[model samples]
Target: MIADSGLVDGLRPSPNFGERRGHSRPEMLIMHYTGMADGESALRWMCMERSQVSSHYLIQEDGGVVQLVCEADRAWHAGAGDWRGRDDINSRSIGIEIVNPGHEHGYRAYPPAQVASVLALGLDIVGRHAIPPENVLGHSDVAPGRKQDPGELFPWADLAAAGLGHFVRPERLSGGRFFGRGDSGEPVAAFQSMLAAYGYGIDPTGDFDERTRAVTIAFQQHFRPCKVDGIADMSTITTLYRLLGALASSPLAAQGGSRGAIRTA
Candidate 1:
């Protein structure tokens, strides 16, 4: 098959993709690690119809780019996930699978070559699609409860440095009034509000339930990478506050939170 994107170094089309639903314009970009020890194995699985999984592109560990599905088609990479109340993520976003073992089979830090390749691909995709900074996210951000590929060692800061995604140096962690799973009250509600406001599929329920913990873990995974104990600590809150502030001051918020006020992070 011909490569969909000229930037792609090669092509290995998968039959697991279909027409995109609802809006044809993609507004998000979801990233993931192959979660397999070998790049060849990951490629084989993605190409198999029975796997029912594919992405627009997959960058091998040695900086090789392979197109598994066309960008216009809805690749079945994001299954049973949500973002800003939209459950059909695969229909509205581009998915890029990076080569890594992930958290299951001896999760390890991504090598420099792989990261650089992904960074370039991300820049190209965002430029072509005009995807907003906030919409670029990891698979764990969408399916926190089920996935954690592209773990903390993925080097989000490097991506940010190259002007690929939204990120800030997390505030230092320190002892303070923290919130955990059992905590329930206005504070918890406020935290939930922030998370929802930041596009996570959660509501301000005033109770730190299981869903809340999951969202918190997701938040830490994306924002405050220093810790992911499922607890809202001082660093987490401060980092979130800074992120919201940046958004508020960005050109995207020209209408002054018309989408939704920056109530929380």
Candidate 2:
């Protein structure tokens, strides 16, 4: 298979892809971590037809890059997930798998060389596709309940410095009124609405449920990295509010939160 980008060093094609149903082209870039002991093993797993999972690209721990699926095809990376009311994430997104052990294994910091390569590749993809800053998202952002690959340790701030995705300095954590699961009121509904408006899939039901908590954790993983407790504390809320404001004034937000579609990283 041909590499979609010049940055790709080689190809190891995977058979776990199909036509991107309904979508004409990818408008979003989703980031994921291999969550395996080694990049080679992870690449092999995605190539196995039985694994039934594939990503357009994979960046190895040592900074090597591999193309697993062509960007023109829909890779079976994102499973059941929703963002900004759009449910067919695999159809509208280009997936890039980063090599990491993930939380379940021996989660650790990303090597600088690997991060630099990923940032370069990500910038190329977003620039080529005109993917909005908000459309560049982590897998956890799209599949909050079922997945958390490319977790908080990912260097999102560096990507933002390179002008890849939406980001803001997290508000300082402090004692304040916070919301969490089991809470119920207008404030809860309002919080849920804000999250939805920012591309998370949640309903303004006036009650904080398990789904809301999951989404909160996802939001924290992306924005409020200092804390990922799933509690809507003052810092989390303030950060979310500022991010929304930033998006409101951005040239891309006019196009859509996730560019043409609406959703995650």
Candidate 3:
């Protein structure tokens, strides 16, 4: 177990992790919610021999922190998820599980204290690890189809304000124009391309398939929390464009603006 940061107040080791493949070091921070009734139950499950699941750390609702797995090891949090072009998310990321009931048993908004703690701890982790702001993502962002824990009510805006994750003010949703499940053609393809360019695991296909809908809802959940009905409205699309612009305007792509914005539409 590597002790890079000692922000975790408690240390409860779990036996569900192994060495990260290919001597991989973490470059991202993936946050999750326990999705159980309480932290103790989630901790117990993660520690059990049969569970075969664990995260590097679990933060309680009362601002308490605990470390279960090690930073150098691959925890069992991000199963079957992709980011950018990488499929082995666990191998390249550190996972932190927060305590929440999740969508299964009535997901609720995280307490203010819990959010504050997450912000602080997340800042500490990302800073120490030198992770890019965009690299700090939610579990739902990585596995949108299979997961929704740490749902839209998780206060991503607060985290962004604290410089833990990447976010932009969402354009308010209006009933002007929108696209949904049955929508298709160049517009859909353009949308997909934008999403893919922003590191979402979506193919730039012109057809608005189920996968595209899932990814849209996931984007809304994190970026535009006003609504998450799997429909990409003007607000969602504009927010995506603005976010892309924000990324382009960053120092990383300031050298040449020719390739930053691709108008697939």
Give residue 5's error in model 1 in angstroms. Answer: 2.6
Cα TM-score of candidate 3: 0.92
Model 3 residue 262 CA deviation (Å) reads 12
Q: Which stretches of candidate 3 lie over 4 Å from their true place?
A: 1-3, 248-265
In candidate 1, stretches whose alpha carbon ends up further than 4 angstroms from where it belongs are 248-265
**lDDT of all predictions:** 0.82, 0.87, 0.83
Candidate 1 minimal-lDDT segment of 10 residues? 254-263
The total of clashing pairs for model 1 equals 0
Write one digit per residue (lDDT tens) for candidate 2, span 2-86.
8878998889999999999998888889999999999989999999999999999999989999998889899999988887788
Instruction: Give the per-residue lDDT digits (tens) of candidate 3, residues 43-101.
Output: 99999979989999999999898898988889898898898878888888999999998
lDDT of 3: 0.83
Candidate 1 lDDT, 153-256, residue by residue in tens: 87888898889888988999888677788888777777677677677888888888898888788888888877888887778877776677677344334334
Q: What is the TM-score of each candidate against the true structure?
A: 0.92, 0.93, 0.92
- What is candidate 2's CA lDDT for residue 74? 96
Deviation from native of the Cα of residue 15 in model 3, angstroms: 0.3
